[model samples]
Target chain A: MKTAENAQLALLLEVAGTPKPGNVDRERDFPDLRFEHFLAGTVGAGPGLRAAEEGAPVGESFERAIAGMSQQEGGNTQFGALLLLVPLVKAASANENGDNGDAGGDAEDAPGRLSPEDVTRVVEATTTEDAADFFRAFDHADVYVDDPPEDAAELDVRRGSDAIPAVEERGVTLYDVLALGDDADDVAAEWTGGFERTFWAADRLAELAGSAPASATAAQVYLELLAREPDTLVAKQHGEKTAESVRVRAQEALEGGPEVVEAFAESLVADGVNPGTTADLTAAGLFVALTRGEVSV
Target chain B: MKTAENAQLALLLEVAGTPKPGNVDRERDFPDLRFEHFLAGTVGAGPGLRAAEEGAPVGESFERAIAGMSQQEGGNTQFGALLLLVPLVKAASANENGDNGDAGGDAEDAPGRLSPEDVTRVVEATTTEDAADFFRAFDHADVYVDDPPEDAAELDVRRGSDAIPAVEERGVTLYDVLALGDDADDVAAEWTGGFERTFWAADRLAELAGSAPASATAAQVYLELLAREPDTLVAKQHGEKTAESVRVRAQEALEGGPEVVEAFAESLVADGVNPGTTADLTAAGLFVALTRGEVSV
Candidate 1:
């Protein structure tokens, strides 16, 4: 029972990670919610819903596949696009101290408890760029382990990629992007074009960074590029790349300027990305990455 | 988000329908514990982990699948198995009114918040039998709906059966017990034989019963016959009559006293059925069906 109780908390903290002010203490109480069990049940029944939405399968095996996975661990955990963000969840709850919690132990074996102060520091240390870094690095690392090192730069990416085919199959798109089929190039080309014309040329220049900013902000570069090729495959790639770039640039810009982080985040809000969504944050990271030349499109 | 949150809580409360006293209100904080996202994750992952340990396709797909489900809407909620019993959990936090502040609202609403008083009531109201009934009924019910009814007797069995095929495929023994194949007859025979030996033949029953008072008190008489002859197959011609007889016997015994309930449950326990496992719980339910003449063992 002690294990069961603790297991509940462990899972919730794992998913919710850290808590921000105004948000629930995700890691603290979320496990007590039993959200996964509910998902298993709903999703287990969702095939019927899926059957109703899409026509029923000719045989039971299709439905069985979904159900077969249901009670299987993480059967109902698929969050489509949100899944990519899950790798950073542990980092959110992880105590930076890496202490083992024994007074008799050496400094290396100190307790790893995250105090409210630690929570504040970690939250402060975390940024959109960090999150993107998490995604990029997470794909290449063993994010799941008994004692995942705090600074393991390279993880078993092959192993991580091998675990979730959907990540590859979907190719970052929330839908069945991997199943683009024979017309993959055509569909990719068109979406790419739309991405360039709509989000890049228009949204970026007009709303994000203006054509002529005070300095060569990554956001400014993003705006300029979109202006050059409004409707092209390159634009779409640039758009996503630009967001990633902006995040990186912004973090660098904010170094030693503690006050600027909040402002930069708010600017992202003005640009229409939900701070909660990964794309917007990625864009913020792109800023820092572009400025530092750490990543280029 | 609200509905998702509520659904998460509902799932937890459902799973933790009944818990022992001190077990519900845990003292530890969330990150301080080790939570299993898949309550059945360990059990479900059992095969996968074993397979991995044995050098099988320790592929990321299986583990990824489990991890995905770990953050499922219901997974991150506060209501996991023993986790919900924690007094601080919002689901268990109630107002002056006895309402689990958030329970009856849609899954979109917060989970009917359970107050300490409400938690106490829920804990008191729930028995192992009640918990089993909840799962069986949940098995039959449509989990996608916003609010699952509180009354287990009112659940739709046919719809519940819809989930059966999928559960069968997953081999989730808890909800899939009724789905045994050719070997079911053999297993059923063994179960019945064990029941007869443990309950019907035991003359020192009173002594055993008195010794384990908690166990003895909740034992139901009809549950005894259920313990002995679950899954007894009767010919179609005699099936209805047999089922009716069992039902009559059950109703009459239920009318006798709580002691009958105690006796029934005690005998089953003495037979060594752990209610935590879905297979055992379902088997017990089968016992009830047979004893009540609902089905032939």
Candidate 2:
């Protein structure tokens, strides 16, 4: 429940976050998904995400959660967030699974010390059906992702669940779809790189959250991450230059300190720029922090 | 589930709401109860609040929910809000009890109408133990209700459950305690008068929530109500005149429209003037709206 609840709370905090620029906060909504949709989707995703604690397969949990999200009005309000969460949720619950015996060999660390290999194992375990469900989730939320390279085969997200048949015919696993996008998608990068950035951000969030309100801590962490790198979602939606500019603005705000961050938020919203990938990262970080008990659920 | 979820969601929305002046929003935390405490408290109270649908006595539901709230760090972050929500949540589920047969006599109000008389019935059903538990909840949350009237003789809230013997000796019910404060407390007034304002605000929230996000709609409703009259808690903490001035300021902001409302929010927070009772009202209104299926849960 901690894993699932933390993931849900992280998503809630991410959406409730103010002056978060372009992403849907309590004050704004995207044409594709209203704020309520995001909330509904997050809540809807709960039971599926928690199954990891009960030793459910990682792919199966992802499929259930994605199917649940699709039932909401928005096709994919938090697809990136969900993708980031699946591994974290599963990893957080990995220890509960370890109750049978020691799947964990690292006695130096605690029972569920998240290792890069575990992430790889979980990702590689995803089935073609999981791939299909991921594609089907697109029907519920039109999440921003780069167009496949011209050499890539047909895979329109708008096809809903129809594309699942093609994926199976091609024997393309969910990992294959994510591998193709890893170069341009932070979420996919998390999967491919053993969630390196998520672990790092989670550490960073742990250090920063103690001094501020959780939401404020989250916003600052988001701005810090945004300043560090251009958000991939922004780049996908509006070219790399625009994404860089958003990052530059964040960097500038950071240079001026916390007070400037609020002004930065207002201006970003005014300019219609959203550093969504960073927000997603913040959520991932929050998941990590929550799992580690650095932040309360 | 919607009843429990809506109740929990309403509490989350109330706490997450920011720039609404001096209330304990996500950005700020009261010394005794951090914002996270409220979130935890609300989530903690979920199961108990949902029992109303199972034909649980209103007092039983209230007692269970209050006990749940006490288990959280913030003993009384939402004491008034929970008090307001108890009957409202139960009333929202009132129709479910009708599954066996129809107890709903008012068809004009629709499928699940929360009537004043129903609220009264719920409050009237409380036993001295319920009164005892209510006092115990104070140990968890130090809600700001006025001191017992001079004529009421030993009705101290600080007595914890220890005062239940006195309460029983006096034969004073929970309804009697609420009735004692109805003249000066909006929540108590709702209990005594059949929740007229809650229903009215619910209607307003339904109208406004259509065009705006739920939190924004809730904020506007809070301001509208605040503008109309002084908040009882604000009046208790900072005197009636100060409360009236806060209402006047809200009214002034209303005169200038939405943009001014934002500025008014800054000033209110700056002045440390919080219309908590009205915020409580908005939360109640949201509960009614959510329960009625007028607002998304």
Model 1 docking tier (incorrect/acceptable/medium/high) = incorrect
Task: Please provide, for model 2 over B130-186, each residue's C-alpha lDDT reduced to its tens digit, 9 standing for 90 to 100.
Answer: 666666666655677778788775667767666777887887777787788799999
Over the full model, what C-alpha lDDT does candidate 1 score relative to the true structure? Answer: 0.27
DockQ of each: 0.02, 0.20
Q: Count the clashes in each prediction.
A: 91, 10
RMSD of 2: 4.4
| TM-score: model 2, chain A | 0.88
lDDT of 2 at A182: 86
Q: Can you write out model 1's per-residue Cα lDDT over B108-195, one digit (the tens) per residue?
A: 2333322223333333332323223323333321222222224322232234444444444443332123112113232222222322
Chain A TM-score compared with the true chain A, each model in order: 0.23, 0.88
Q: Which tens-of-lDDT digit does each residue in A1-297 have in candidate 2?
A: 245766777777677666566677666667655666766666667656767655676556776777666555556667778887886677667754564234556653356565555556677777787787778666655666667756554765556577777788888788888888888888888888888777777778788766866666777777778888889988887889989988898889879975787787777766777777788888888777776777653
